[model samples]
Structure formats: structure tokens, C-alpha cells
Target: MSLFLEYVKIKIKDFFSYRFTLFLFLLIDIIYIISLSVPFLIIYSATEGFPNWNIYELFFFTTTGIITSTLIFTFAIVIGLDITDKIKDGSFDLLLLKPVNIYYHMLIQSLDLRNFFPDFPLFLIILIILYPLVGILFSWINLFYFILIIFISCLIFIGFSGIFISFSFFVPHFDSFWDLFFSFREISRKPIDIYKNKFIVLFLTFVFPFALWNYYPASILMGKIDTSIVPSLVLMAIIFLAIGFFSLKYGLKHYKSANG
Candidate 1:
């Protein structure tokens, strides 16, 4: 944890040293947020409300998705893509020789501060806007669920992204895999319950557990479901944990130095 703090301090120091670069990163973060949100904003503007969820309630889903995606982007880009770059440039072998648990080491590695920093302001704005709509239901338990769900979603994001990048060991230059991975992750961004097809809703919810990112917890806060959320979350935590650990071990075994 001290090491992680030092990494964060360095990021802060770098942020000051390169003000222009930091500004550009912040600008890019804002633009990316706007781009991803415009379609949802348009839909809300046109209809004024979704079928099952009102605008304010849907904001929960929207913010949840944004938060999770930003987290995933930061985690995956910092670690997965870094690994990819090193592998391509023949520098990854050095990383493999570091005397530590490689997976655990990567877990605490430096994070992209800008990736989720901008989202904090937007999240504050969402809370202000939703104060009236959610004030009545804002109890301690609901808040606990909200925080727990967000934390678990981040873990899932990390695990899933790590698992996908693990494929890089077996398939060099796997450009198409990233396309498919992101496409599949896109499903986690929307309110899956609104779909007409119940099977898909169920699949994404309990089966693949994509809904755990936003939809399930958002709906839970809205009183859409009961205690069933417990087992579903437990199952998801297990699945992602296994995938994360298993992928790290398996992928590391296939690792060959650039010289080899």
C-alpha cells in the first residue's frame, strides 16, 4: 500500500510537471465522457423517460455504466496494454524477472488518474440532480448496497479485462480480440432489463453477469428485485476471481522472452 501511495504521489508530481499534458488528458477525458453519454442524453431528451425507469432512475444506470467503464479502461490500459507494448518492443522479459508475484505486482501498479478523475465531478452532479428523486429511498442499507455494488463491479471489470488480455500470450497481434471484447463489454453499459427479450435480460444478468456492472444494482436500489441479488453477486464474485487468478497463471506459463 505504501508503494501504491508512492506511485500515486509520482503521478501527482508528474501532473504538475507537465501541466499541458495533464490538461490535454483532462480534456480528452471530458470529451470521451460526452461522446459516450450523448446517445443516452438524446434518448432521454426525446422520450423524457424510459419505459420502466424515469429519467432520474435511469441516471443511476447511466452513471453506473460510466463509472465502471472508466475503471475498466484505466485498469486494462495501464496493465494489459502496457504488457502488450512491452511484449511487442521486447522489454516485457524484464517484467517477468522481477522478484515478486507478477499478478499481485500488476494489481497494485500505477493507475491512470485521469481516466476516472473527471467522472467524479459528473457523479457529484448526478447526486445533486437526483437528490429529490432519491432522497426518500436514501437509507443506510441502500447506500451500503450502492457502494458495495460499485466496488464489486470494479473487481469484475478488472478480472474480465485481465482475462481477455491474457489471450495476448497465445495470440500475438490480436487486434480483433480487443474489438470483440469491447463490443461485448458494451452490453454492460445499458439497462439490460429494458430489453423485450427476457432471456437476454436474464443471460446478461445472471448467466454472464454483465448486468452486475450497473443494471442489477441500479434496479435493486429502485426496489425492482428482492434478496436474489445476494446469490447473484456471490456467484459473480467467484467467477471473476477464478477467471482472474486462472488466467494470470495460465498466461504467465506461456510467456516467452522476446529473445526466445
Candidate 2:
């Protein structure tokens, strides 16, 4: 635990060390957030009102999606890049020699503070805009479901990133995988309801777990979906977690270190 804290501190310091770089990243993040929200904003304005969805509900989904994507982009993407370097330079072997779990170490080492800084203000802005519209009804059932949605979203994002990074162990060259993953991430920013096919939803929720990230919760909040979907969302998150861990473990077992 102390080691982990120290690692986090070092990461924070590293981030502060590059002020210009940090500013550039923050700028990029702000631009990305604006770009993501614009389409939804345009659609909402064009429609005057979403067929069945209200402003509060739209805000809920949009805010959650932005936060989820921001975290994934900052944390997961950094780790993905680091995985390639570790595999190439044999630093991963050095990590394996440490007392801590290699994956945990890698995860901690990949931490960056710059990505999260912008999200705080943006999230606050969203909350300020949403609170009056949604009202604090405090429904226990809704709260439980909301928490579950957040949990599942985090798991799905982490699991997807883990699977992507693990491919480095087997593929050696992962540029194509990275490209495809980025493209998928871009697509996922849109409301999942945009996809009309039930099969596509099933594939995303059960097979990829992307639906839990923003779609499932948004649907529920808007009253466009049933509460029964929560179970499947939980199950999907668990399944993705299992798959990610096992796949990474398998990849590690096959990793011969560049020297071998």
C-alpha cells in the first residue's frame, strides 16, 4: 500500500514536471469533451425534445459518458502505450521480479494526473445543470441501479483496456489493434440507442460490455428501458473482468521477454 501510494505520488510529480505538456493534454481533453457533447447538443436542439427523453435524462447520460470516456482515455490509453514500451524494453520482466503483482504495478505505473483534472470542473458543470431538472427524488431503487451502472461502466472500460494491452504480448506490433480500439471508442460516445438492432445491443452488452458504459444507464434514467436489464449489466461486467484477467494471465505466460 505504501509502495502504491509512493508510485502514485511519483506519477503526479512526473506530470507536474512537464507543465507545457500537461497544458496541451488538458487543452486536448477540453476539445475532446466539446467535440463529444456538440453532436448531442445539436441533435437535442434539432429535435426540440428527444422522442421520449427529457433534458435531465439526456444530461445524465451525456455526463456519465463524458466522465467514463475521459477516465478511459487518460488512464487506459496511457497504460496501453506503456505496455508496448514494457514489452519492447524488457522493463516488464524487471517488474515481474518485484514483490508486488506485475499487473498491479503496471497499472499504478501508468497513472497520470493531468487527465482527471479537467473532468472535475466539467462534471461539476453538468451536475449544476442537471440537478434542477432531475430533482433529488432519492429513489432507493434508482440509486442502486445508478451505482451498479457506474460500477459496470468502470469495469467495462478497464476490461477493454486490459484486453487491448494484453494483445501486445502476442502480436508484438499492436498499431492496428490500437487504431481499431480508438475507432470503437469514438463510436461508443454516441447513445447506444442509436443502434436499432437488438442483436447489436446484445453483442455490445454481453460480448463487449460497452453498452453498460453509457447506454444501459441512460436508457433506464430516461424510462426507456426496464430495471431487469441491471442483472445482465452486472453479469456482463463480471464476465468482462474474468475474460480480461485470464487473457492477460495467459499472455504473460506466453511472454518470453524480448531476450528469449
Best by TM-score: 1
Query: After superposition on all CA atoms, what RMSD does each candidate show versus the true structure?
Result: 3.0, 3.3
Scored by Cα lDDT, where does model 1 land? 0.67
Residue 223 alpha-carbon offset, candidate 1, angstroms:
2.5
Q: What is the lDDT of every predicted structure here? A: 0.67, 0.69
CA error at residue 140 for candidate 1, angstroms: 1.3
- What is the per-residue lDDT of model 1 for residues 80-129, given as tens digits with 9 covering 90 to 100? 76665565566766666789777656655536666656565666576557
Cα error of candidate 2 at position 47, Å: 5.0
lDDT of 2 by residue, 1-260 (tens): 88778877887787778889878877886787677667777887788755555656666777767666556656666676777677766687877888978888887876766667656566758755775586545556775776578667777667766777678787766746777656665555556666677887676777655666677765665556779877767777777778778888888888888631
lDDT of 1 at 251: 81
TM-scores, in order shown? 0.82, 0.80
